[model samples]
Target: MKIGLYFGTFNPIHIGHLIIANHLAEYSDLDQVWMVVTPHNPHKQKHTLLDDYQRLHMVHLATEEYGKIKPSDIEFKLPQPNYTVNTLVHLKEKFPANEFALIMGEDNINSLHKWKNYEYIIENHDVYVYPRLKSGNIDPQFVNHSKIHWVDAPVIELSSTFIRESIKNKKNIIPMLPAKVWEYVEHNLFYRK
Candidate 1:
């Protein structure tokens, strides 16, 4: 199977994430889009994030109805502070028959060169980039790279941080999240500081 790995913290999976992943699964050649729930990196701020399993559960809730999109907890089992290159290598080993690609925003393309062993990733895997509202100039080298494919998907401007803060401030973030996921968050009283 051809799979596109869409990595995110998914603090609480929301509609924006579903839109992009669904788009890739339906419009692109990828057979399925895996919403790889990223584990919290000890190097980053932890106060804002929910627990790893909590986030993964939300992802599962958001994607449960989508046949082409699935939730993944692969990163949770891998070592922390892990790079994408390492994850790619690990996935290749674990699922040798499947062809794995990357799903990322246009802004990430600008910083792709800085990733560890980025050359290996670019050379081995296809990168499916969707548009972002505030993406800066992309690196000239990747502008026309064969491994990179620019997908004309919707530019979703929503964010998990915005939803979290809205909930904390007593705003209705219901429309921003999937029904089941929003219900889960409400029942658990998450982000309602």
Candidate 2:
């Protein structure tokens, strides 16, 4: 099986995240796409993040209806400030029979050099890069090579920061998030003041 790992904090999985994962599952060559809900993102701020379990549950709610897009909690057991390289290595060991690919946005592709052991990641994994809204064609050196694919997934501009801010400000977030996710947020009062 060819599995595409879509890594993210998914602070609260929004439509944009879902769309990218769905594209990888249905449109790309990937057999399935798993949204790897990270406990912490090394490159990002951690102060405002929801608890890892909550974030994982939110991802589950957001993707429940999508059979092709599954939610993963593999990072929860991994060390803090999880690095993509380490997770890929661990997953490869655990699921030896399955071929794994990396799923990321074009914006992430632009910052590929900054990631931990990014060279190894590029060399070993088949990467499916989706487009980000307002982002022009970003061609990194690694993308010029084979195995790294630039996917034409639609650009959905929504961000978790915007979703959290909207929730904190008591703005309607139903349009930005899935119905189950929005309901879970409202019921749990996540990201509220």
Candidate 3:
């Protein structure tokens, strides 16, 4: 089976995340899209993140009804400051029969060279990139890679950081997240300042 590994902090799962996953599953050749819940992304700041388990649970709640969209806790057991190449290697070893691919945004493409063993990842695994609103530039090296494919999905302006801030200010996030997820966030006092 071919799976797309969608890695992110998902401090709280939102509608935009779901939309992208659904889009990839429905329109792309991927059979499944796993939302790999990262404990801490080496590239991102830690202070703004929620607890890894809580974020994972939110992903579970948001994607519970969709069989193709799975919530993964693969990174929780891995060492801190997760690296994509290491996660990919571990997943391949664990699921030998499954073909794992990388799912990322065009914005990430710009910084591909900075990631650990990024060249190896590009050469070995398939990459499915979604367009980001402000990510106008793409790395030439990424463009030259044979395994990379660009996917077109609606570029929603919503972001987890914005949603977190909104929740802190008691702003309505009904439209930003799934109904069940929103309810869970409210009940759990997520993003409360």
Candidate 4:
């Protein structure tokens, strides 16, 4: 089976994240999309992150109804400061029968070279990149890579940071996230001080 690994912290999984996963499963050759819940992303700031288990639970709540979309806690058991290369290596070893591909935004692609062992990832795994609003053209270096696949997905200007701020201010996030996930956030007071 071919799977697309959509890696993120998912402090709270939003509609945008679901939309992309659904689109990938429906339109692409991928049979499923696993939302790889990272404990800590090497490239991102640590202070803004929510507890790993809480974030993973939120992803679970958001994707519960969709069989094709699964919440993965693979990184939770891995080493600290989660790196995509290491995660991919581990996944390849464990799920040898499953063909794994990387799913991410074009904005991240611009900075891909800075990631740990990025060249190995590009050479070994296929990458499905969705466009981010205001993201400029792809870098020439990345374009030369045969494993890159660009996807046309709706650009929703929602970020976990923005959602966290809204929750902190007692603002409505119903439109931005799934109802079940929104309820989870509210009931748990996830981002509230």
- lDDT for 147 in candidate 1 is 97
List ranges where model 1 is wrong by over 4 Å: none
Pairing residues by index, what is the TM-score of model 1?
A: 0.98
Ten-residue segment with the worst summed lDDT in candidate 1?
Answer: 39-48
Q: What is candidate 3's lDDT per residue for 10-110, written digit by digit as tens?
A: 98888999999999999999999999987865667667687788888889999999989999999888887768899999999999999999998888888
Model 2, poorest ten-residue lDDT window? 134-143
TM-score of each: 0.98, 0.92, 0.94, 0.93
**Total clashing pairs for each candidate:** 0, 0, 0, 0
Structural RMSD, model 2: 2.1
What RMSD value applies to candidate 1? 0.8
Q: Pick by TM-score: which candidate is best?
A: 1
What's the CA error at residue 178 for candidate 4, in Å?
A: 1.0
**On residues 1-193, what C-alpha lDDT tens digit does candidate 4 reach at each position?**
9999998879778998999999998889899999998786556766767788888888988999998999999988897876889999899999999999999998889989899999999989999998888778788988867899988877767888898898889898789999988888887778886
Which candidate ranks first by lDDT, i.e. highest?
A: 1
Better of 2 and 3 by lDDT: 3
Question: What TM-score quantifies how close candidate 3 is to the native fold?
Answer: 0.94
The deviation in Å at residue 116 for candidate 1 is 0.5
**Per-model C-alpha lDDT, please?**
0.94, 0.86, 0.89, 0.88
> After best superposition, candidate 2 residue 15: deviation in angstroms?
1.2
Cα deviation of 81, candidate 4, in Å: 2.3
